[model samples]
Target: MAHTAEIQCPRSISEEDRARAQFYQLLGTLLSAPPSSELLRGLASLQGDETLLGVASRNLAALAERTNPQDAEREYNTLFIGVSRGELLPYASYYLTGFLNEKPLAELRTDLMARGIKPRSNVHEPEDHLSTLCEIMAGIITGEFPCDRNLISQKAFFDAHLAKWAALFFTDLEKAQSAVFYTPVGSLGRVFMAIETDAFAIQ
Candidate 1:
């Protein structure tokens, strides 16, 4: 579960980097919980872009304009928290190894511990959850965690845990039958991850 709080910025970074980190935080927040009325309203106010991501942004904002909070909640539940399992399982472990709580998750936990990061006590989901991973990416950029990780460390973490699986998950989310409000989210995530992967490759 995501806390209703701002994404902390430990210090100043390039404006582009700051915006990228904010985008990750936004995705993390939206995926971790259903949108509140205020959040939906805020989303509705956003303008769409002309780029591929912009198209997704516009569509999502348009969807938000007509979506009631209750209906959005129901859609979220149906897509992510159906009675037992959701239409898609948004976990690194599952996406990587075809099983939940598998080696990928264990490896992620080890890496997180090494970086002096720990999952929130209230969030019972594994650290490999999509939302958790997004939060970690945001933290890496923002230095929200206690440790001082440089760009190299950030790239290493992304390559190890996120680069392989996140894009696939987003692609699945984009095509899921239950997706409406989440489709644009899927687009945003997919495009963002692609950008991250390419960015890290040359760094």
Candidate 2:
């Protein structure tokens, strides 16, 4: 008879990991769709300290307070969905390979499969979409999947998919002509990505 071995359960995620995951999730949520009135209201209540990232967060909240859902929706459409293509394309493949659904996207898909990550049935965007990638990072930290969800795994995924292109994209977004409510969002992203990059480098 063959001997069976016990499978050790994964360790519980730390509080710091949970907070980091929530930040990624927040980014994913904000980028995934136009901000609803409730979301805008929540944004308007955000407060921050004296640091650069905190200042950016405060600015975002201030902008959110002044922005209405109708205007925000229009801005979203203009920035992300123009008549054909938006001013900016938020895809890893496009940023890295200069084309949609290119090699980067294919590589991301392969990795996602290897990690047993399946996209939601209703999600039509490729796995390399910025929002999708953010959500994946959050899931990885939260151990939403059975695979490796350690700090090393989180760092690997972020270094590969987000660290290179996400900051550039956010910088573009901050300066885009159509950006109003999203400008502060872009600033926040830029600062957050820099922090994440630096933190990961030191680890």
Candidate 2 residues 1-203, lDDT tens each? 00111233656788888878877887787777899999999999999999888999899999999999999999999999899998989999999989998988888878777777766666677778788888888878877765588779889889988988999998999999999999999998888889899999998
* Stretches of candidate 2 exceeding 4 Å from the true structure: 1-12
Clashes of each: 0, 0
lDDT for each residue of candidate 1 in 52-120, tens digit (9 for 90 to 100): 777877888898889998998998999889999989889999998899999998998888787777666
Spell out the clash pairs found in candidate 2: none
Against the reference, the lDDT scores of all candidates come to 0.84, 0.85
Candidate 1 residues lying further than 4 Å off, grouped into runs, are 1-9
Q: What is the lDDT of residue 154 in candidate 1?
A: 81
Judge candidate 2 against the unseen true structure and give its global Cα lDDT, from 0 to 1. Answer: 0.85
In candidate 1, position 56 carries an lDDT of 76
